[model samples]
Target chain A: MRPFTVHTGTAAPLRRSNVDTDQIIPARFCVRSTRSGHADSLFADWRDDPGFVLNRPGHRGATVLVAGNDFGIGSSREYAVWALQDYGFRAVIAPRYGDIFRENSLLNGLLTVTVPIEAVEEIWAAVEADPAEPVTVDLERLQVRCAGNVTAFDLDPDVRERLLHGLDAIAMTLREEELIVRYEASRHPALPTTR
Target chain B: MGSTLAQKVWDSHVVHRVATGSDLIYVDLHLLHEVNTPQAFDGLRAAGRGVRRPDLTLGTEDHNTPTIGIDRPIRDLDGRRQSELMRRNCAEFGIPLHRLGDPGQGIVHVIGPEQGLSRPGMTIVCCDSHTTTHGAFGALAFGIGASQVEHVLATQTLQLRRFKDLDITVTGRLPDGVTAKDLVLALIATIGTAGGQGHVIEYRGAAVADLSMESRMTLCNMSVEAGARAGMVAPDATTLAYLRGRPGVPQGAAWDAAVRGWTALRSDPDARFDTSVVIDGAALHPYVSWGTNPAQSVPIGGRVPAPADFADPEESAAARRALDYMALQPGTPMRDVPIDTVFVGSCTNSRIEDLRATADVLRGRRVADGLHMMIVAGSAAVRRQAVAEGLDRVFAEAGADFRAAAGCSMCAALNEDRLQPGQRAASTTNRNFEGRQGKGARTHIVSPPVAAATAIAGRLAAPADL
Candidate 1:
């Protein structure tokens, strides 16, 4: 995972709410064992329509997505995050996000910014007015800057620290090997074990 | 302060605590299914890592497995490769898997509880969002992503950020014809989709206590749809009865001791919660979603709501778009809406009790002409139980297709069991998102009884209506 510190990229405005993972990468496209090819299937259901925002002229190479409330609302599939990253999106800015989707994005290095609806509206306005308007997401500052406006966002400090460095949470977890082994020794005997 | 049930389970599992941010909690059980998880195994191999505790992990073939014609090799190339990879991966890791055609093989969530892998006071994580289903036994369970799955596979632990506690009290007995599905749908409607954001909900009160173990599982399974981190009901006699003599349950004296311990796992009366919601359960009717999202629903006897009925601009816009996609007219009675298909299966409501409820409704009835109905069980155990009770005969005689094997038949369109472009279905699945059943299928989420009743009426109708 590449560390996400500060990124400035062109924006694509998606004026839709509850944009679930199913639509991000449909179930049919989720078959492949690998994760990279999802870029082609991103929004596979909607891309056929010429009027879809991603297909619009100026938004072609966007690396930031500004969407409505409740983004990534369904399915725990991390493929949704991979699809966005595969499509060159460094981050996603939304008013709200599904709890699981937010965690998935953090672990996979896709920055999920939870800004106020007003800030989301402001960013969308800026992108619609000028499709190539640069949006800056500063993880170090916990802020988003676009069109001369600075909007603050909130992320758990631990998550921010982990993202600042490319995290290996499993390795970090393994550092407490002694504690884990002790706890396991005393765990309930009634618990199920595949062994 | 008095500790809540969620707090008790969470605090008990902490192997190590970080200074001010998170806790390294021990995971008791890690369930795996064959979808979106192949990458996790690939990562483990690349890093030269082996599973830390294969004893605590179990895998199954569910999400993408074929429900019918499964006796032969899986016909779909993609589905076959996934199953093969799952068999090989579990074998390589030395983890036990309930493979295809195995008696224990079924939906991961369903078989876990049936085989007693999901019991009280344990911390369980799976890659599927419906993992909250195990919380019915008072366990702390939630879904994780691919990276977290790998984290659990490699270390058997998860770095956790805390969630605020939400206490949802459902008082009074549920009305007749109202099942757990309807009760949960009602709760989600009261609290919008994002209402439970970043909170763990502990469902309690007389109404919840009266529910069966399977009903409690149904309630917890859809907690994710309401945007909750997880949902739980404290273990009780009902939970004990369900776990007695199941596969992993301890024997005789050991079981008694386990019961004594689980009996103590409950929220104190004075427990403090960040938020509270109270619902009068007796007043809830059989709910059926009219639009795309689960919250966009109303009582069975009510009419479809107009967009103007919503005060929030975003909700109003969403309602309008939902109506357009649903092809439904405002002011139309819900019972008047026609459905071309009826599907009764999913992690949400595919247990034996759910199947029994569907069978009770369709016993002497026939599916209406021109309607396609498929009744899939949650597990082979559930399927066999249904057969012993003659529910399969009831379904077949009613012109409904009772599946031979248990898998996620049509809840998702992972295989050939899906609707065509523009077909509308009254489904018991947890989701009704656009194209969920298939490419252009519109789904109205309902309970098992409601699904069976709608199948016979050829429209959205409650059993009482019939």
Candidate 2:
């Protein structure tokens, strides 16, 4: 995972709320190949319409996605997060996110910043008014700034630390191997196997 | 202070806690399926780590296997590769795997409890979100992403945060026409999609206690629809009776000790929760989804909800979008909504009890002239039980298609079973997300009885309506 401290990029606004994982990347694309790029499959159904925001010329290279509340609502697949990163999105701003999706983002070093719905609307309006304007998301300071207006956001401290240090969870857990072994040994051998 | 069942199970599993971060909790049982395990195994190999506790981890090939053909090779290239990869990965890691031909092979969620592998007070994690179904036994079971799957495989633990407890108590006897599926649907409909976002809900009260183990499993299975990854009901006589003779269960003195432990796994009488909700079971009918999301539902007798019914602008807009995608009109009676196909199987409601319920309804009734109805059992064990009871013959004689049990068939269209464009289906699956069945296809989430009646009526009809 790449360490993420701060990133500045053009923002693309997705006005629809409850944009589920199925819409982020459909189940059809789920079978293509493991560990392959899914950029082309991102929002495949929605992209059928030429007017979809991401398909428009101005947002072609946008790297920050400002979407509505209740984003990533269904499915626990990390493919949705991988698709966003594959499409070059470094940060996603929403009023709320599905619990599992948010966790996946944290582990992969893709920054997910949560702001008030009003703040999200403001950013969307600003990005729509001027597509060329860049938004800076500073994780170190916990703020999202755009068009001379800035909004402070909140992130779980542990997740923020993971993103800041690019820590690998497996490596960290391995350090406590003895503890795990002892815990396993504590369970009575007379008990049935949990499997 | 007394602790809720969730807190008790969660606290018991803690291995190490960090002051600035979450605790590392030991995972007792890890379940695996084809869709999410392949990439996870790849990650484990790349990192040069073998499974820490292969005995505690079990693998089964689902989500990509064909329900119609068990003896033949998988025709879908991706499905075949995923299944093959899972076999190789499990073989190399020394994890016990139940293959397509194995009677124990079925949907991961189904076989876990049926085989008595999911015990009370245990911590279970699977790649599939519906793993919450195991929580019906008082275990703290939830789903995880592929990355978390790898984490559990390597360390036999998961990084975790405590979740708030929400006790949902359903009182009174369920109405004659309503089933446990309807009760869960009504709960989700009342509390919107994200209502239980950060909480673990416990289903209890008079109505919940009266339900059979299979019915209780159905209630816990759809907890994800309300944004809760885990749902629990304390184990009692109903749960113990269900597990008495199942495989992998302890025997004699061990059984007595196990029962004592499970008996103590309940929430204390004075335990407090973050939130408490009470539901009247008698008021619920056979509920069905009218829109793309599970929360967008109404009773079978109710009409479609207008966008204006939602107070929040975002929710209103979402409802409108769902209506558009579902091609449904506001104020239309749910019973009048026509369906092109009826699917009576999924991890949610594909057990022997579900088959028996559908079979009772279709024993002498004929499927509507031009409509198609399909029945797939939850597993080979379930299929065998159904066959011994002559449920398969009842389905075939009633003009419904009876197929073998495989992974996730129509629930997710990874196999040959799928709805085509512009087709609408009444399914017993958990999610009704856009194109969940197939591209341009719409799904109406229903229970098995409702699905069978809908097939016979050629529309969305409840068993009482017939």
Candidate 3:
């Protein structure tokens, strides 16, 4: 995972609530042995429709997905985040995200920005007016700014730190391994026997 | 400050809480499945490590095996290789395996509970997220990744940070038609899918207390949907009664002592929770997801929401997208949404009880023309019981497609059973995410009776219609 700060690229409006992982990366595409090749398959069915937002020629390189409320629900498939990353999306701006998907995304280094529903609408409107205009997601300030409008949201401090550092849950746990080892030794004198 | 279930389980297992804020928690039971076990086995092989406690570890083939044919070789090479790998890994590591052809073979979640491996106050870990289903027996169960699987296999312990407690109490008697499925769906819909994030939810109150063991499993099975770490029900007579004389549960004097310990596992009368949500069971109706997410649900009689009614334009747009994907028209009654298929099996609702419920609704009825209905039992044991009770005959007589054995069939398209592209299904499975049934397959999460009724009506029909 890269450690660069996220600056939301041009916003592409996709007004859909509850955009589940299955829609993000269909189950068939998930059959790949390696997890990295799913980007091209992201929204495979929907992308074929000329009317789909991501398929529209003008929105080709848009890196920020401006979506509606209750996005990324369904299975805890990590491939959904991988597909979004493969599609070149650095951030997903929605009012809320499916709990498991949100955690999966954050753990995998995909930026899930939760703005208020009003703020989400404002950005959606801005993107709708001009699909090429960019929305800036300042990681340091934890704010989203677009078309002279600004909104800030809270991220659990631990999750925010892990995202900024591009560390996974395992890595975060491993960082405290020494302390864990010492604590285990002291607390479980019979640890070897259990093993 | 009184202890919560999460705290009680965590405290009992914690070797130590270090200054760096990590603890070594002892793991009692480790469950493994094909999809994620290969890498863990490889890691162990590479490190020259043997499974620390093979007796405590259990393996089953579910995710990659073909649900249709147990005696024949899997035609899907990839699926076959995954299953083969689990077989070899388990054999090499001396871990007990419930292979596809064995009567013990079934979904790991179902097998563990039915075999008496999932006992109260135990800490269980598996490679699959739905492992929380074991928490129904009052154990602390959750999914871990492949690396963690290897870690547990080698060390028999997990490093962890404990979670806060959230008590979600559902009071009052459930309405006649409502089941545990409705209660969980209602809870997720009320709280939104992320409402239980970072919390270990303990299902309490009259309605939850009265649920059957199988029903409780269905409730805890979807805890991941709410982003909860796990969900547990304190063991009571209902739990003890279910465990008594099971294949592996303690016997005689040991059983009495086990019950004594389990009885004290409940939250103290004055126990406080970090967060609390109260629900009225009477208000819950059989729910169906109109959109992709479990939270995007409404009562059977409700209409799909019109985008324009949303306060946020973005939310409106999202609703529009979900409708487009689901092929549903806004403001349309959900009952009117035509379904091409009805599936009544999954870890969520494929037990003997669930099968019996579906049979009850399907008796003397036939699936409507053009609808493809499938009933896949959760395990061989469940299938055996259904057969003995002649439930399979009822399903067959109703024109519903019935399979002989069990695996995670239709619930996910991991095997031969799948929905054709653009197909719509009413499924008893937990998720209704787009393509969950197959590529471009649209699913509506429903209860067993609703699934059976929809199969009969050839659309999204209510149980009351029967």
Candidate 4:
């Protein structure tokens, strides 16, 4: 995981809303056991069209994705988040996101910025107007700036702190192993088990 | 203050309150499948950590397994490798796994309850989003990503924020043709795709209480479609009856003590929620999706909605896109929408009761000429049960293709069973998102009976229409 303090990159605007994980890296690509080779598979179906946003010459090297509402709306696959990072995307800005997708992004250090629908439209306009214009997503300031217009975004405090530190949450939880053992002994007696 | 069922379960699992503003809660069970778990194993190996509680974690191969040919090697190279890797990984970690040929092998969500592993007041997590199906037993079950899967495997805990409680109380008896699948579809249609985001829903009132355990699982399975992480029903007589003789359940005096606590898992009479919604169950009909997402649905008798029907510009635009992708015309009767295939199985509705009810509808009917209908069980165990009940003969007699093996066939089409380009299906699967069944495949999400009737009618027709 990489610490996400601030990032500035060219933004690519996805006009469609409710882009699900199945569409993000289709089920076919999901078979690959490794996570690093998914860059080419991101939006594998849509990318076949020459006119797809990311396929355009100007949007070719973008590292920030500005999409519509309910982005990543289905599936709990972290492969979707891995595909974005594998494709060099540093941050994703959307008005709304699937609860699980947002959580996956936080753990992987891929920043997800949520703003009002109006602010998202503004960012979309700036990026669509000039694909070369770089947009700044500042985690420290809690704001997204594009085309001299600044719009603020909100991130959960719990997630924000971990992303800022690039923390491995597994290690943090392991530190409290004693507490976990104690908690287990007190679990409901009826809870089922496996041999 | 009175606590809701979700609140009680959630509070009971809390191990520590972090200064960083989230609760660190212990996980009682963690279910794993072939997809999205190989990376987690790799991470665990790299960090030199062993599974903290292998006994509490269970793995099963389902997503990429074939619904037919249980004896042959997996044909897809990538899928075969994934399956092999999973076997090796589980072996290395000393975790028990239900192999593809084993009777215990089935969809994780299905086997969890069947094995009596999902009990009230427990906290369960899986790599698949539909893990919420276990919440039907009054457990706080939800899905997680690979990183979280690894976290739970290593430390048996998760750090997360709390969710607001939403009470969805359905009144009156559900009409004959409208099953739990329809009820949830109607709910999602009323509340848009992201309606329940960040909330945990407790289904209350008469209609919910009347549903059987399988039906309750069907309702909770699609909670994610409404953007909710978990949906639950308090444990009661139906839940107890289903678990009484199942393996892994508490016995004798232990069971009595457990029942007392389970009975208390319900919401207090005066419990307050962040939001409350009441639904009229009698009014709902068999519902089906007209577009790519679950929320883009309407009753079987309704007509396709025009983009203009949506007041929000973004919504209208989305509707337009969905209509274009689905190749549907506005104002067309949903019953008249033709389909190329009909699928009657998925984690959502592939249990013995579902099979029996759908079989009753399909018993003497003939599948429309040239239209294909397929029925696959949620697990090998389910397939065996369906066979013994003669549901297979009924499906075959109805001119449908009843599969011999069991897996997530056609639902996800991850294992060579899928719709081709320009193909459309009336399926019982949870999602109707673009190409979910196959590349360029369009789907109308329906209940098992609706799928059966649609197959016989060669279109989207309910049993009542027949």
Query: lDDT tens digits, residues A1-195, model 4?
Result: 789999999999998788999999888888888868899989988999999999999999899999999999889989999999999999999999999999988899999999888888887888788888889999999999998989987787867877898988898888888888889888766677877
Worst 10 residues of 4 chain B by lDDT: B404-413
Give all TM-scores, in the order shown.
Answer: 0.99, 0.98, 0.85, 0.99
What tens-digit string does per-residue lDDT give for candidate 2 at B210-293? 999999889999887888869999999998899898886878988998899889998989899998889998777899999888
Deviating ranges (above 4 Å) for candidate 2: A190-195
lDDT of each: 0.91, 0.88, 0.80, 0.91
Over A1-195, each residue of candidate 3 has an lDDT whose tens digit, in order, gives 465366868978887666766678775555444446677888886887799998887788999998876677655556677789888988889987765567566656778898998898899888888887789987778899999998987776666665677754444445555655654455422111111
Worst 10 residues of 2 chain A by lDDT: A186-195
The predicted structure with the larger DockQ, 2 or 3, is: 2
lDDT for A133 (candidate 2):
89
Model 3 score (lDDT): 0.80
TM-score of 1: 0.99
For candidate 2, what is the DockQ-based docking class? medium
Taking the tens digit of each residue's C-alpha lDDT, what string does model 1 give over A1-195?
789999999999999998888888888777678768789889988999899999999999999999999999879988998999999999999999998888999998899999999999999999999998899999999999999999998888878888999877777778899999999899977788865
The worst-scoring run of ten residues by lDDT in candidate 1 chain B lies at B71-80
Per-residue lDDT, model 2, residue A99, is 81
Off by over 4 Å in 3: A1-15, A51-71, A85-99, A102-195, B18-24, B36-54, B144-161, B303-305, B308-315, B329-337, B462-464
Model 4 lDDT tens row, B1-466: 7999998999999999888668999999999999999999999999999999999999998898987787899999999999999999999999899999998999899999988899889999999999999999999999999999999989989999988888999999998888999999999998888988998889988999999999999999999999998999999999899888789787899888888989899998888899888999988888999999999999999999999999988889989999999999999999999988999888998899888988988988899999999888888888899899888899888888988777778877889898998999999999999989999999999999899889889999999888
State the DockQ of every prediction: 0.77, 0.63, 0.21, 0.81
Clash list (residue pairs), candidate 3: A15-B317, A15-B318, A16-B318, A17-B318
